[model samples]
Target: MDVIVSRSGGLAGLWVTWHVHVDEQPDRDDWYLLIRELPWEEPLPVPPEPDRYTYRIRCEPHEATLAERQLTGPWRTLVDRVQERSEPERGRPANGSDRTRPPSSRRPRRGC
Candidate 1:
């Protein structure tokens, strides 16, 4: 399974994207559970704050979607964990490890 999270809609409207191949993730099953816990069938609600960042998470092969309002419970956990791990460290990979990722247009992960 693949897990991708993208954050868009801040004051500047720039998008930040992150993703992980769940099968290679350390806690793969846990991520699967979190994905299951999200309300995939529901359409994302209108953002309460137009400028407040909202996340678009696509797990299970890009089939599900959720809104900021629905980002409670496990949804919150999933987002938080993804955000935390996606932050790259100096000389560290974007996924926070030695494992290499496919090339993309995203800026190189910056070291703290």
Candidate 2:
């Protein structure tokens, strides 16, 4: 299984992404359990608040888009775990350096 979590639309309007392949993780079962617990079938919240962050989660056949305020409990845990265990992508460094954009082909396009 593969999981990807992307956060965008904060004050700086930057896009940050994290990815994990369950087979590559030492704690694969734990990640699977967390993924199974999410309310995947539930409706996504309304559009995000102005200047607030939004999260887009994708786990194989399932995907969800969430407003920042909707991130909590299992959703929060899953996102945090993925970000913690995976390398930051799209020019965001692991050492907390300033985020830089990669080539245009790698840039995340706005909107669905």
Candidate 3:
């Protein structure tokens, strides 16, 4: 299985990170990390149009591993970790209306 996560607000300048693991050697193209940084403007796209400076980490599995039992999952784990480290709750609240454009070609819901 795979997971994805996004983090926004809180610290003035902070970076988001994620780690993913699969049952076996899966196609690299099947999964990836996408980062979209919100610009200082109105009507920001859901994904911020894949900001050139956005932060993301793509997971690559080891070459020799096989018959895997556990997977690293998705960035959600990292986001949860960040939340635990930063605030008392699960990071900041997501205001979807703040965005003007809908989610980009990317899949899944967009949160801020």
lDDT of 1: 0.58
> What ranking emerges by TM-score with the best candidate at the front?
2, 1, 3
The C-alpha stretches of model 3 lying farther than 4 A from their native spots are: 24-112
**All candidates: TM-score:** 0.64, 0.77, 0.21
- Deviation in Å, model 3, residue 6 alpha carbon: 2.6
RMSD of 1: 9.6
lDDT tens digits by residue: candidate 1, 46-86: 44567565666666434434446656777678778777666
Tell me the tens digit of each residue's lDDT in model 3 across 1-112: 3232233322332323233332222542333222122111222233332322232322222111111111133333433443343322122223433322212223332221
TM-score of structure candidate 3: 0.21
**Ordered list by lDDT, greatest first:** 2, 1, 3
Tell me the tens digit of each residue's lDDT in model 2 across 1-112: 7787877666666677787777778988888788888998894665748778778888767888888889999999999998889877653333344332221223333221
Error of 1 at 25 (Å): 1.2
- List the RMSD of every prediction in angstroms: 9.6, 7.2, 16.3
Q: Which candidate has the top score in TM-score?
A: 2
Highest lDDT: give the candidate number: 2
